[model samples]
Every structure is written in structure tokens, then in C-alpha cells.
Target chain A: MNPSLHFRPLRPAVAADGATTLDLLITVRSPEHPPMQLKERPGLNLALVIDRSGSMAGSKLSHARKAARFLAGELTERDRLAIVTFDEEVNVLVPSQPVRDPLLFISAINTIHSGGCTALFDGWLAGATQVANQLDPAGLNRVLLLSDGQANEGLTDAEAIAAKVEGLTQRGISTSAFGLGSGFDEDLMGAMAAAGDGTLAQIESPKQLADLYASELQGLASTVGRKVSIGIRAKHGAELVDLLNDLPLTSAGNHQLPNLRYGQELSVGVRLQLPAWMPNQEIASVRLAWDSPDQEGRKTLIEQLTLPVKPEAELEGLEVDPEVAEQLALLRANRERRLAIEELDRGDLRAAMASIEAIDQRLKGLPQSDAITRERRLLAEKKELMTQDRNLSRKRLRRESLRSSLNVWESGDDNV
Target chain B: MADSLSLSTAASLGSDSLYGLEELLALAGERLGEEVTPRTVRLYATEGLIDRPGKDRRRAVYGQRHLLQLLLIRALARRGLSLTAIAPLVTCSDEELGQQLLQLEEPSPSAEQQEALSYLQSLQGERSLSSSPGSSASLLPLLGSPLSSSSASLSPQRSLSTRSAGRSNVASSRWHRFSLAPGVELHLSESASIPPAGKRREAWLARLLERLREQLESES
Candidate 1:
């Protein structure tokens, strides 16, 4: 269960003066070729919760059904699948059962049609219950909720629903949200997915839904760690200024992170104000905790980072790490882009442009990579496209920003 | 050409010569024969086919540049030009734009074609109402289809050329001096400006400036 957890301060050393502030990056990397070493991988017990409201009447329903059928075809006989669809009333079309016959699941999925009001929370609860009933400690137990956002029928508040989702995550049944389109409340869906320790996919169309589903299933199959979270324990004199990732924080103050997929790096930026250092004292430590696959308890990895105390003269000569700078730039880009979208919505174009301009300034001297170049292109493209249509622009900006920050960005962009 | 131009278009191109949406539409209707509507004009502006109207005292208004661009787009659309095909025209100079518009007579759209255009327009209206971001329709360059590519052909080089003018050399003659402590002063060039991106960057810059101040104090 050993994974790489690293803490890298931008500057290798800290000045002894209490006035010196340090910026750092925390990275948790998943093993790239783990399934190759293991004899067997855990099967997925997934609950597919779909919204069949009246709003999903025409092409939306047709494409959703097609996506669902395609997903059913992707599952193996080792996996357990349950189909719980909802309108004003929730119905369990396929009970929790083994995928001995993909045909049966697809047939059941095809029979789904549009109905009345959206009972989103109820539908999700029904799906989470299905996974919990046949809970497998060794397997991946998850609820995949596909919705078009409005949950008018029952328990509609986002904060309340996220709380319930986190409760399910605690019981080893994580929930991921697949928001259908522009109508999908990005903040709500993103919040729920973050709380549940799963992926939040902003599906712009029914066609992309199938591909996103396939990728998500691929992620589930190759997940290295589940219930992954980071704990920040600041040493007595040190102060944690800010965490740049827009992550969900637990009541205990741990940052809930996405479940680790092979080759995925979950990195976040932080700034710390350390008091006068004495010798090589450890100022702060970051610990990673995830569900242990080998045993009943949890797996833990600790990385204590302390800068080499040096005089002010020596500290001034040190250069910032490029990796840390890039991460910081990416993090700043994610946050500012979202703020710029909000500024656009408020009809303040200059402020929106300035918000993005700030990010461009931040990227001025950073070493260029595919990642950095991608950030530059995204910032420019979003600024250009943000004025086209308010609803669509806002939706795309939020989703892309969220996706970029989470490192789940795919090149299959629907660029105009 | 000035006499042929719609709405007493003055030869002098001052920035103050502005037109409202209604005025642009009225002028466009005179030139293009009523094919231009407020929605379409706004759509074209948003799609980057025309320069976005600037705000003058809280009311969005367009300049002569926007007027010329709108007329060019309306004429081309009347000539059965697809928006993606016409994207390059956005970068044309005023002389070239006027020349191009003068050569292509507005093809009289047939009743069937008019019906088709209006139907497509109504469909666009409906889709934008229930707009899904990143759809194929969003990718199309023609019409008011959320032309992400329309922006591609229009904005990047245009904004860059203007930006590159100042970016190449940030030189300013004026500088200001402020005292940090006894016998220590800080000087800043006028062009050394930073936008209020966020508090974090500002705080970081302030810290670095603080270091500069300390260094100066130690030197003194």
C-alpha cells in the first residue's frame, strides 16, 4: 500500500528571521503500473442512479439510455450492478445482482423513459442504499448519479445533500456525480462529488456521457487508493496561510481528495508563515490517509518537511523550484478563472479580463510544459468565449476549471 | 462611398462616434433590408464576429468600428455566407472591409430561404434557452453558433498585436520616490503596474518589496 507522498517547499531553505514566509506544494502520486503486479483486482459494485424527469424528454433521454446501455456492456460478470432510476418516485429497475447477463441490464436500462419531477436526492439515496446493502469491503462500492441538476421534489439543498453524500462515503460507499448539461448545478454536483471522494464529471452532452462513463469505469478498475485524504498538522510556531485547492474540508479539517487512479497526481499549493526557526526543527507535517486494502484498518504515509535554517543573506540567493511554481500557477489559474466567470456574470467585462490578466502575469517566467501551455491556452480561450452566451459560457468555464484543478482534464474539448 | 454608407457615416473615425443597438439595427436595416435584429446583432458581438459594445456611463454602446463590422457580417450573411467562412473578415481593415462589402451585392433571399433562415434562427433561440455547453452546435463557426473557433480566427492575434505593442518594452519616463526609512527611498516607474488579481499575489509581492526595503535599510 506504499504510494508516493511528497512535500516540497519552493525554496530548499528558510531564513532564520521570523518574517520569512515559505510557499510549498504537496503531491500524492498513485502507482502507474499496480494492476500489473497484483494477481487480482477488485470488482466494482456500482449503483447507476439516473434522473428521468420531464425535462429529460427528447434527445436527452435517448442519449442517456444509450450511454447507460453502453456502460452496461462494459461491465464484466465479476461486477455487481444495480439500476435505480427516479422521477417524482424512485424505482429500482435492476436489483443488486451479478452481471452474469449484460443483456438483462441493457434491456432494463432501455426500458427507462421520461417521467415527472426530479427527485434527485431520493434517487441518490436509493442508489447509495443499493451499494451499501451488498457492501464489499475489498471491492469498489460506489453510486454513480447522473442528473440534470434541479432536485425540486425532495431534499434539494446542496449543502444538505453533500452532508448525506459524505455520510455514505464514511460507510465505504462513495458517490460520484455525472451532471448532464448546463442545467446541472455545477457547484452542487462538484460539492457532492468532492465530499464523497469521487469524480465530478460535467457532461455537456449525452454523447460525451458514454465516453466519460467508460473513463470513470476505467478509473474504478485501476484505483490504487480509496477514501484518500490529507491531514495538515502545523507545528506550534508555524501558521498555514492558505490551501489553494478548492477541496472539501472535513469537520476535523482534513482535505478530502479524489480516489487515486494510476498515473494521477493530486497536488495542491500552500503558503506557510513560519516563526523564527531554531536549528533543523520540523515546522509542519502533512500526512496521507486512505482505506487499507490489505487489512481492516487504514493505510498511513507521513512526510515531515523542515527547511534548512539559513541566514537572510543565504536565503536571498535561493531560487524557487519550477515544479512548485508551476503547481502554484495552475492552482491560481483554476481559482482566478472561476472568479472571472463570476465577474462576467455580473456584467463586468473589464474586471473579468483583469482577473485573467493576473493569471497571465503569474505564468510570465515559469518553465513551459504541456501542463503550463495548456493553462495558457485555457485561460485565453475562456476569456474569449466567456462573452458568447452567458449560461453556456458560465457552465463551460466552471466545469473546465474544476476539471483542470482536479487533473482530470481530457483533450476532447468541444472548442468552437 | 460616404454617400453610399448608411446613416451619415462621417469620414473622420473618432472614438466618440458611437451607436446604440437600436441605431445599429436601424442602420443595418437600411443597408441590409431588415434582416438584422437586436438579438442577432448581440449574438454576433458575443460570438466575436463583431467587437463587443463598450459601456459608456453604464449603457452598452458600439463605436464606428463595430458599425462597420456589423454591416459587413449582415451583408455576408445575406450573401449566404456561413459564419465560419466569414470569420477571417473580422481582421480586415476598414478600407478592405468597405471594398469587400461594396463588391458583393446582397443576394435577395427567396421566401423559402427566408423561411429556412428564420426557422434556424428560432431553433438557435430555443437551444440557447436550453443551451448545453460544449455541444456540436457550440463548435459551429457559422451563424450565432457559439463559435469558439470564431474567436480563434478573430481574437488571439488581434489582442496580441495590440498587447504586444506595450508588452515588448514597458518603458515609462515618470518615476515616483517614497521614503522607506531615514535616508532610504523606494523608486517605482510609472509603467510598473499590477492588476488586482487577488490578495495572495499582492501579499507575495508586498513581501518581496519588504525584502527590498530591508536590504536598502541594511545598506544604509
Candidate 2:
């Protein structure tokens, strides 16, 4: 057997940027010999933040209610859930109620009717507050926010909302943002998710809204893992360049650990190009650390992962293996290409075209077989889309449309 | 009076007095208290079995300790021991070292090691040697047997004369002809061995010698 087989990670390092640093305590057990069972069920605290603005009056509101009903049905009796809705004001439909009566919860969701302007910020703030008040540290604390319209009321500023969400996240309440319509700012949704240390997903059409909600809620109810964070710290003099937690880069920091919700496996991909003088020299070690719920309301650190940065030539020999390098390279290239497109959207067509051409050239150099070839074809299509000189909003939509058409998941081949 | 005169004449004869390969082998054999051959000494020297006295390969002068190690190696080989099995015995000195050596020499229960041992066992059978723990001790008696006795058929005096003739030819060759490439030689010794070949060989040798010189320059 390969010596590396024994080194299988019990708690795998979540990729954060391309420089993954994993920190988790692992309990190793052979698959052939099962160990004594730990806890059979983990306690959960989930808050549903629904948008009841005027825009969610028709099929959007119906989908939200149906989704909530589905979520109510999925929850176990031991799990706790709260329902909160907002128009110009926020309302708590169910105040940290146990999942004891499914019909009653379904009635509560059905009773919600959309009206008034969307106060998304107030809605999230109230839902975050409910979670902060009701969540047990031992249970999976999460705030699932679904919005179909823009934030038009109090504290509508994206940065301020992000700040508030960040506070909620620091308090151990992971928030997942679901945008039900294109009108809702994807950037804002992404920022809020980042602030709350959760994931941002878009349900572009009303038809897919219920299914997305069901899938996300069911995933949450499973609750196999909790308190997941992708911890990353660079070597001396090597500052963290950027970070994206299910969204594009919105904030800058030195060290970061994106908080994660239940069953929300944290995976980060990053890239760092060493100073030219540092060639053939090992930079520093990257470490990742995470904590998971142990019993009732307590959390335990699961693992502390470390990977050394080898010289460019020696990177292939890392114990973590070369797949990590390939993934990092792909992510970096994608990010560069995306940023170039963004620049082009801002009227820098020549620069954007150059970046696109560069990416095309790079793709040509890579192995021409497998899914990468398909990706290159899609990228070429995206470049053609950019050549149309579309407006920023149109360009973004077109780019997203092209990306969705590719049928490739955003993370990388690992998920595929 | 005649014997004394002959001895004086021999002492004055510098041509016969010069040391050669066979003479060197006899000197080594005498120091080791064993019959050593030029081939065995050369093999040991090439394999680094014997440590060179001086830093220079060209100027290296082999002597007693090297001859002793050669004798030990030959004795172990005769007893049907592999180089790997005898390596520890040659290097270790403590009483407990013998147990460690034995453990290393013994085949593990693993299938791979067992297979290797089986192959080695078959080869040992061709020489009619036993695989017993005390088999090495039997080599001493075998050294005095008929097989070894016949090895003395060649006159040692005649061997010495032939070797001396070869040495004279080598000595007369130009020093430049023996010049190794600059960076090719790893040793810092002024008298490093040069290759006896072409311009490409000289270029390669120069590169190695230069590399060695660079290391010395850096250290200084």
C-alpha cells in the first residue's frame, strides 16, 4: 500500500483561497472495524428569514411558503426552528419553536402574505437577533434568509448590513443567503452570506425556488458536521492577498476563517505567487483549524491541519499531493479570468479582451483532454459574450448565464 | 662474501626496488597476515572498501588497515555471506552488534524477503556451502585447504618483476596526459587523477574539477 493511504484526513482541510490551512482534531478508525458510536443525533437551531415584500406577492411568496412547509416537515422533533418575515418591518412567526407539530408550522408559513416595501436589512437583522437569542452553542445555529426583492428600507447600505451579519456570524450563527430573483443584489446577498459565515446561492427562477429550499433545508436537517471554518494563516511577510466565501472578494484581512453551518462543508481555494527572489525556497507552512459540536451545546476542536510550501520544483512532492496544486492553479486562472471580465464590464474592453485571450492561451497549454476542454470552450464563448460590449449588469448576467450553461460547479472538479 | 656482494648489488638496483601493483599487493597481504591478490586490492580500492590515505585519488597510498578490511571481506564472501549481511559485521564493534547484525542478515517472514532469501539459498547450494549460523568460522579452515594451496603456483618474485615493468611505463607518461578536467575532480588535492581520454572527456573532467575547486573556494 502507498504510505499516503494511512494519512487520509479524518477532517479534511477545507480549501480557503488556494493556500489551504486545515486545523481539526481527527479520530482515525479503519473502515473494516467500526468504532463505538458517538451521538446518533445532533441538536439543531435554524431560523428561517423570509422576504414578504410586495414583489414576493405571487408565485415567489407561494414558493417561499411551500419551501418553509417542506422544511418544517423535514425537521425532527428534537430540532428547533423559528420563522421570521419582513416587508417594511420584521416579524417572528415562530419564536424558537420545537419541531413537535408539523401542521402548525405549515399553517404559520401559509399564513404569511407579502406586502409593503422590502426591508431586507431589517429582516436579516431581526432573524440574526432571533438566532443569537435562541441558538445553543452545542446545536447547529443557522439563519436561512430568502429574498426576492431589493433592500429599500432601514440600514439598506450593503456594508452596514454586512457588518451586522459579521457580528451575528461571530456569535456563531451561520447564515445562508438565497436570492429568489435577479432584482435582489447578488453582490449584497453574497456579502451578507460572507458576513454571517455561510453560503450564498441564487435561485434565478421561481420554478426552482422550492427545490433549492428543500435541498438546502434537508441538508441542514441532516447536520452531520458543525462549527466548520477554513482557518488560514500565511508565513511571515506573506500576507493573505484575498478571500472569497461562496462570493467574490468583498473584504480584506490578514488571517481569516470563514464560519460554516451544519452540513455546510467548508472548502476554500487560494493562490500565492512568491516574490521572484524566493525561487527554489520553501516559503512557510499553511495551517487550517476547525471546531465541531461535541455533545449538547458544546464545541470541540476537531483538527489542526498543516501543509508546507515547497519550492516551485518540489511542490509536486508535498504530502498533500499534486491535486491540490492543480486545483489551486485552476482556481487562480478562473479568478483572473473573472476579474478581467469584470474590468471589461467597466468599459476596459481591451484589457478584458487581453485577459480573456491570456486565459485562452493558458487553456491551450493545459492538457487538451477531459472536462477542461469543455471549460475552455465555455470560456471562449464567454469571451465572445464580452466582445458584445454589454453594460456591467448585462455583462454580469450574460457571464452568469454562460457559467450556468456550462453545467460545471463553481468550486472545481472535486465536487463534480 | 659473495652473498653480501649480491645483496649490495640488489640494493643499488633502483629499477627492481620500485614498488609495483604486485609488490603493493604482497605488502598488503603480509600486513593483513593473509594471501591478497592485486585484483582484490584494486576492486576494494575502486569500491571505496579501503579508505584512501591522502585526499588525492592520484596520490592515494594504500596500506595495512585497508588490507585487513579486504581480508575480512574475502573471508565473509567465502563463507557465503552477502555484502549487505557482512556490512554491519565489518563496521560494528560491540558484542551486542553481532546480534543486531544477525537480525539484519536473517530473512523476515514477509513474502518478498522470503523469496529473496530462497534465491540466495539456491545460489549458496551451487558452492556447497551450509547456511548455518557458524558457517563463517569454517572459512579459516577452508583457507588452508587444497583449493587455496594451488593458488601459490605463480612465483611471487616473478609477479613482482612483471608489475614493476608495467609501473615504469605508467611513470614515464607526461603529467599533462594524466590531468583531470578542472571541475570534474571532487577532491581539493593538487594531485587529483586525470582521465586518460578525449577533448569531451577533458571538458567533462574540467567541469567536475571546477565544481570541486568552487566548493573549496567557498569554504575558504
Candidate 3:
């Protein structure tokens, strides 16, 4: 077991007739007694699916090729890599093979040229197939897709694409999408990453592609856990509304948690609806489980808290955890920003402006972090653009929406 | 683009941000992420789910306040609250309204509800509503699908034991074990499981055992 990993629930005892909110802070504190380092890190089964559409003919294609070549250099012989490039038709440039020959891999990637329409769906499917063929049970399995255009050739529907990505996620194949330039569908890529249990990035300019790829690859190489699932067993009549960063969560029986990396703490804020319950009723119990690659075994970390139901009047005096309150405020602000951007996309400038103003007002009273400050500036800039110009750029809207919804600003990296 | 765009400014009201009913509906629809009709907006106004547009019915104009009100109403409506129940709450202070909104946000279902939904979906996919619940062997694949580990699924070496207080609470105590490696193994026990199945006693036993282990170490 990885003793460093810990699950702490910052739950408050609040009495409400309708609902209450809770937060679970998941942290990885280094243990006092560190374990011996293994001789070798866990292997990775990675598929690089690059789009070679005509839209990517110039800088985008070259930058992607450079990134692929650079990624090959970072992987060892133990890692398995598959390179699949797609235009109007999908082609396997290099099948899944051990990364023993970096020269061969780099040469193969360099041969890919931009042309024709984008077969994004088929390209991703082919890459996933390659990863599946060499699927490492104890290693990280991921399909990293880079697209510069929409899915014009096959599977054009965003929901259909997302569902397929989710299917692969269920089958233990994680996927992350990188949208290059303005033409690619940010919504589709965001949906894929969210459902695929991975992260999404918008490479707004071609120049940033290599750096983004490098950062993502670095994170992927350090993956400590796999198949991480958090199943919430809430007491009956108490429903959970949203998860971390205002991510939409349905009132379902079980939830599959996203993978976590070392040295980072992930916090999930759960909004629970409480029907009037009898005093001393058990509110909820959370179960945390994951597969440990280092231990080469399935590991379980459980932290279950039972809250007693209290009368609404009694709960009024109970103060919420200060940290929980702060996190909730940030999440609500982000959600409002997202909604505002969506309104902008729908051509309702007035509502979008209102949402932006609401976000600005909400942010005013919250604890400001670097991420929050950046978001506020971006929102302000966007608001100014909306006020001055009636014509809103789809690219800017898509990028802003993806950035807010995916919690990308929260990360230390300034450019994603 | 004209149909899609809200170009009409509230000229008489002297504020570009202010809007008429047609524009309000469009803005409300966009903010709510759903189609909000003029009639629905009027209904919301009449029921006080949202504030009335202006003092005069002949020349009414809605501004930022009305837009926010309708948006909040739309949000509350999404949370499964009827307009009548949401009306009084809409007029509260911002902080109070926020607190109420957080309170009204739907909670996630319990573990039992998720299992029932999954089971129903599986049955619907197989077109086997009346088919038998199958055996303990069928449960392994579902568990195995998520993890890339070899022994993550239930194997022959795995053992499930239970000690119940009564038929009503069959999962009062349960034990589960699976061999992780040569000498290492995972042992878990929990008091979590759904209620007894109607007729499929065998299936319930299998599912109960699965729940016990899963609950003991819920996935994150």
C-alpha cells in the first residue's frame, strides 16, 4: 500500500430541511518513513494519434511532428508506443512496439504530412486499437489525440465521439485530446477528455504545441495510480449534485474518479440534497479505491463519515468549515464563468454580460489565488470584447470555455 | 445570424443592457442552456418565479436584474423544484439565495440506486427482463473491466463470506478476499449492500458480496 496517499473528508454537521454541501480533500503527504525506490519505473502503453488534415498543413503539422519526435526521446525501451496519423483516411505509421529505437520512431513520425479532411474518430479508434493490442495490465495505457480540424470524414457528432471515448475509458484505455489552432472543435475535445477520464488542452497557437506536449508527457510519465474509482455510498434520500470544480455529476449510485498524480492534491466538493430525516440518521459513506502500479496490486483507501441529521433550526448556528466555504466559492465562480461563456456562444450577449458581471462580483469576496486572478483578468477581457464588438470569435469562446470547464487555470502552468 | 443574434436594444428604456420580452426570452434561453419561450417567461413573471419586467404592462423592459432572476429561476427549475416552490425563495438576498440554491442542488444517489440502474441497463441491453440473474461468474467481468491489473477481478482463489444479523440486513457483516500477487492479497469487509432482490436469491447473494468488497474499498 502507498501510505503517502490519504483521504480526508472536511464535512460539517449542518441541519437543513432541503440540502447541504460537503468537501473531500484528497492529499498525498510523504510518509515519515519513505519506501525504497524501485530500480525501474512502471512502463507506459501510449498511442500518439495525430491529425494531418489540410488545415494543419503548415505550422500545426510541423509542431506536432516535432513534439512526437521529442516524446520518443523521453521514453525508454521498456515503454510501448504506437504512432497513428489520420487525414481523410487513417493509417498506422508505426504499430505498437517497444521504444528501443528512437531514431526509427522519430523517422516514422517525420514522414507524416498534412493533407485531406480529418478522420478524427477513425484515427482515435485505430490508435486505441494499437494500445489495446499491447495493453499492459500493470502499466499506464493512454491515447493522446492531436487534432487541428473537425471530424469531417467520419463520426461528426460530438456526443457520439464522446460516448465512444467513454466506452474506451470503461475498458481501461484513457484518452487526452489536444486541439490545435482555431478550427478544431473544443467542445468535442473537452467532452472526449472529460468522458475518457483524461485532461484536455487547447493549443491556441501552433508555437505552443511542443511545450504542451512535453508537459503532458512529463505528467503521464509520472502517473502513480491507475483505474482510480471513488464510489459514494450516500445514505438514502441524500443526493450528490456536483464533484470537483463544479463538474456535472448525476445522482447515480457509483462514480468513477479521475486518475491522480503524485505531489498534487485533488479536492472534490459534493452538494448533497437532504430530505427531512429523523435525528441521528446516517448521511453518507465514501469509499476510495485505486490500482497501485508500484505495488502491482489493487489497493483500497477507505474514509467513511456518518453525519447525524439535525433540525434546520439547530443547523443554522453550525458554521461550515472555512476551507470548504472557500473552495465552494471558487467552484461557484468557475461555474458561473462557464455558463456565461456558454451564453456568449448562444449569441445572447446581454445574458453573457450579466453572467460575467456575476462572476466578477462573486470573485470580489473570495480568497484570490493566482489562478483566480488570471481567470478574472480573462473574464474582464472577454467582457470588454463583448461590450465593444458584437462579433464574438468562436475560437476565443471555445478556448475560454474549455479552460474554465477543465480547471486548467488552477494548474501552475500559465499556458495550456 | 439575425434570428440567432439579439440585436434589438431597449431604446425607450435608454439602456442597451435592458431588453424587451422577446430578447429576454432569448437571453434567458441562452443563460439557462435551454429554450425559454415568451409564454414561459410571462408565466414565471406571473408566478413571481421571476420579477415582473417593469412597472407598466404597455411598455415593459427587463434589465440585468430581470436577466439574473430568470437565470436563477431556470437553475432552480433544473434542480427539480416546481415554480411555486421556487418563487418566494427568488426574492431573498444574494447570499441567502445562494445558500438556498446550494441546499436545493440535488445529491447523488446512494450506492444501491446506482446498482439498480446498472442492473436495469444490463437487462435492457440483453432484452432479458425475465431472465435469471446468472451466476457469481458473471460478476467478475464487470469488476475486471475497469482495472488493468491481472488479479483485479474475482478469481477461483477469491473467497466471499458473510455473517448477517437478519434477512432485512443481509450485509451487516461480509468478508471478501482476492489474491493480488504471489503472497500479497486484498482482504475487505463492509456493511453496505442494497436490499434483497425480489426472486433472484442467487443473484442477490453474488451482488451482495460484490457490494461488500466494493464498499469496503470504494474506487476513487
Candidate 4:
């Protein structure tokens, strides 16, 4: 199924004699959701990389084990899974195999006990190898690295880890990360997922691990596109100002979008500062590419945005598309949310509050939608939480930040 | 007339935001919550910690920039970082210095704690040892496995709704974060009930001092 893609410029016609800048919103509408898509799922070659460390002694380890067992039970003979657990040492406990018997998977999951220090890099590498070993082109292959971003022993550098994950993603293997509880740096975990073309989530408790796993298993089953990306190249000397997804940019200056879902409405906002161009000129070219989930090979969709340049008077008379305006508001809000979260992390409550209040004040001017209203209300709630308890506020805010930035949650309220 | 606005606000604003030395002292005292004497301000300037205050009509005037720079000098100094170490970090624009002050506020994890938070995360659902069925796949050749393809799942149409997620803050533990490297940290724990910078902060350093204990870890 092909996704419908289009571009909407904030100003349909750029001001030829006025401001030379334009805001373009590229939206890819996925094929509509078919309910029957639930019953049949692509074969999954997945790795569940578990961390059985000393620190994860209580709820963290227990919840993770239960989640692993539950996830193993969910798969069928058609699906293949590999389990790799690590502490000071990395162990491939369950090699990649078909989920034929529940008792065998259960016995393996039950043997997982807390061990020593963290060898995060080596452990993840082990899990990735498992998936890569049993890689199937027609199936979804992923490594769910359960870690807390603490890599003491092996490769502790985040950038290097992210680069490795990205390389593996390019080789048809994706990795997702889940760090149990709050206050842990989601940035590192989130960065890996974003780099690996997968999902990153902050699990609040060991118990939430099972729920998160169930939802993610369902999400994986419904995966329609792998390594979905939007490549926007400038045309006619137009400069790309910003792409507002807060995603890690590729060396070629593009974004790795979340895997496309059935009926995926991927709306990405890009700002373009146009140079002198006549009416009816191509300002930018957008290329959407994804690997077909069921062995259909790599697919690419290209669309050239040819916006008409108008004189200042004509441009002034043009109305902004409501869709473009709405996209601009949400993306702008997302940016402010990031700034606010950064301030909170830096231990500046007043500044964080001030930023949220200032943005909430700014949002009053935009054409308000239910989404914008919720964004303002949520920011206010975060501020309220800060005043009550700084610790709780920080954790809650980080989770909210993850949800907003990634938009990867399968169900339930945004707060979870 | 140009001096009516508060010094720090002026410094954060434009050139029109200048103030007298006394006004700078007062705000610094309030920010640092300690006596910020003119002598100390002058000492900072003499030591080249802050930019030399501008002279408006030969009466030494200061801006918000001077104040932030002053606070940063004191902040870095309080961190026990020598002037040389502080020099490279403080060499930025007023805006960047402001951000740096905010970043410097939080303390880094100590070496021992850093070791604890150092993470090796990957999820393995199976135990291969003493398990014959699952481990047999490890012995199987990779290329020989059948590669059968299937379809993806059906998803519900979704949007960012104002749904309040009810959380269970039970089994709460003091989460620890350790510095793996610069621009990266490993935060273990569900809750980090850190004291507000107010009670323990050095007036101006209050924002950055909250991490002083956290810094106690990484610095150690």
C-alpha cells in the first residue's frame, strides 16, 4: 500500500517582493487502517536484550522478567525470538528460534537473575547480533534493549553507541530501548531508538514493563514500514531553516521518521528561506522512503514542491492554510516543550515555568485547536507538579517529553 | 532614565539596560543571597572573571551581562574548579553563559555511584543454559533458517489528547545518575527527591548548587 504524500506552504505564494522565507508542511497520509490487518502480522525476528544487574534487584528486574515471559508467550511458531541478558558480562541466554513451546521460553526467562556491573554496549551488540543472525527480509527485526543508560564497562560513549545502532538499522535491524522508572536520562535511550529507526520509552515501574511490552508487541505486529525517512533537499537556492521533529539528522541532512503505521498521518514541518525565484518554481524536493514490511523491497516516493512567487501585495492578500497553521503551532509548541524540559533538567524551575507560561501566552494568539489547548493545559500541569515536588515533576516531565517528541505510545493517556 | 530597570534584567535585555554599581551589588547580593560588596565585584573584574563594567558619564555602570558573568565566576569557583578550568567554560556570549549557569547548577554523579549507574541494557527473554529446545537454534546455521514474511497489525487512529496518565509512585527509590561522559548521564531510580536549590543554594548559585551533591559523586 502506498502512502499519500503532499506539501502545504504556510503562504501558498511566497512574496516575490516581500519576505523571502516560507514555511512548508510535508504530510504523508498512510494507507487507511484495515481492521483485518490485526489478525495477520509479518513474521518477527526480534531480540529481547535483558539487563540482569545487581541494581535492578527488586521491582526493576522482576518486572522485566515477567515482561519477557509474557512477550515470548504472545508470539507464535511463525515468529522467531532471541533473548540476550547482560550484567558485567553479556549472555545470549536464548538463541534466535521459533516460539514453538511456551514451557521452554518460560524456563529460560525464569533463569534470569540479577548479576554484576553494566556492560551496556557489549550487551546491546549481543542482542543486535541475535536479530541480525536470524534476519528475515519479509519480517520485522528489532532489538529491545532494556537498560538504564548506564554504560560503565564497555563503550560508554552515547554518540558512538548511537552511531553503531544506526549502522545496524541501515543493515535491516532496528533497536528500541526501555529504561525502567523515571529520572533516568531518556536522551541517551531516546537517541539510540531515534538513530536505530525504532522507539524509546521510559518505563515508570517494573509492572508497567508488561503493559508496555504488550502494547509494543501489538505495535510491532502492525509495523507497515521500516526505516521510514523523509529527505528534503533544497531547490532554487532555497535554504532549509529547520525541520521540527527534534529527530537525529542524518549526514545527508534528513530525518528518520517512526516506522509508518497503517493509516499513518506523518506531518513534518520544514522552514525554507527562499531566494529570488519567479512564479511557479520548485523550491524544494521531498523524498519519502521505507522498506516494505512484507518483503516488497525498498520503496521511494518523490514530490517536488513548486510554490508560486507573488508580489508583496498579492502575498499579503493570501490566506494561510489552516492545516499549515495548525502544524506550525504544534511543532512550535513541541520546541518550547523541549526548551522547558531542558531548563528543568538544568535545575532551573523558575526559568522552566517562565518558558511554559510564556509559550502558553504565545499560544493564545494561534488558531486554537483541542490539541493546542491540551498542550497548554499539560504545560500548566507540569508547572503545578514542579511547585509541589521537584523530583516527581522532573520524572513526569521527562516521560511527557518522550511521549510528545516520539509520539510512540500505543494506547492510554499521555501521562503514563 | 536608562538605569530604572533591574540590572540582571537589563543585562539579559539590550544595551539600553544599564545600571549603577550599587544596583548591580544589590541584585548580586539578592541572587547570591550573601553580601556582594563593591570590593568583591571589583575584585572579580580585576581578576578578569567578568567584563570590565562600562563607564556612563565616568560613573562606572554595569549591565545584566556583567552580573551573569560575575555569578558564573562565583559558581565555577564554588564548584572548586580553578580559574584556568573555569576560563574555557565561561568564554561564551551572555546568553550562552546564562545557559551554562543553569547547566552548572546540577551536580554530577560521583565515581562510585557513576559505576553503579553505568548501564548495560538489553532484554533477553530466554535462558539457554540447561535449556535444550531454544539453545539449539544457536547451533543452527544462520543462512539455512527459513525466511517467511507476514503482514503488520491494525492500529487505532490516534492523536495527542489531554489524557491524564495516573501514576503509581509506590516502591519509590532514590534514582542515581552518573556521568558516562560529557552530555550523557545514566539516571537509575524512579524518584530523585533532591532538595530544592533554595535551602542549600549560594544565593545566585542556588540554581546550579542543587546538583552539588550530584556533582560530589562525579567529581569524586
> Ten residues in a row with the worst lDDT in model 3 chain B?
B163-172
Error of 4 at A195 (Å): 1.3
- Cα lDDT tens digits for candidate 3, A1-416: 25343444455564546455545544433233224665566788898999986677767788888889988988887888888888755777766667876876787777777655677877887787767766566667789999977776545679977876776665567888888776678778878887776768776666776677667766665566655655666676777655545343323444555555655455555666667665667666666566765565667666555666666777667665656556555556655566776787798989988888887787777667776676677677777778675333344455455442342412234332
Question: What are the per-residue Cα lDDT tens digits for candidate 4 across A11-71?
Answer: 7888676557788888888777745545578788888988776667677777788888999
Report the C-alpha lDDT of model 1 over A1-416, residue by residue, as the tens digit. Answer: 36788888889887786566889888888877775457666888898999887667778889989988888888887788888888766777766666766876776777777765667877887677666656677778889999985776545679977876776677677888888867778777877887777877877777798888888888887787888778888895888998887776766778877788778788878889887787778878888988744346778899888778998778878987888888887887777678887888789988987888788777866888888887777677766766665666676667666753343424276643
Clashing pairs in 3: A229-B219, A229-B220, A230-B219, A230-B220, A239-B107, A239-B108, A240-B107, A240-B108, A253-B114, A289-B218
- Computed on C-alpha atoms, the DockQ of candidate 1 is 0.01
- Candidate 1's C-alpha runs over 4 A off are A35-37, A344-349, A403-411, A414-416, B1-220
lDDT by residue (B1-220, candidate 4, tens digit) is 4433334344555766677899888887787767778888887777777776666656878877888887877765653344544454455677777875674454554442232122221212222221222232332232121111110121211210111011112222332323322222233343433433453423434443344334434444
Of 1 and 3, the candidate ahead on lDDT is 1
How far is B214's C-alpha from truth in model 2 (Å)? 99
lDDT, model 3: 0.62
Q: What is candidate 2's lDDT per residue for A1-416, written digit by digit as tens?
A: 00001122212322222433332221121123112465544667788999887677778888788888888888877777778888765676665546766765786677788655666766765565555544566666788889976676544668867776665555566788877765677667766765665656666566665566666655554443333333344453444454422232323322334433332323345433333223233333443333444444423232323433333444334354334333333444556655674675587877777776786677676556555676566666666666563443333433342221111113222111
Mark the regions of model 4 whose C-alpha exceeds 4 Å error after superposition: A34-39, A387-392, A395-407, A414-416, B1-220
- Per-model TM against the reference: 0.63, 0.49, 0.58, 0.62
RMSD of each: 28.6, 35.9, 32.9, 30.3
lDDT of 4 at A122: 73
The CA lDDT at A159 in model 4 is: 85
Clashes by residue pair, model 1: A416-B148, A416-B149, B83-B142
Better of 3 and 4 by TM-score: 4
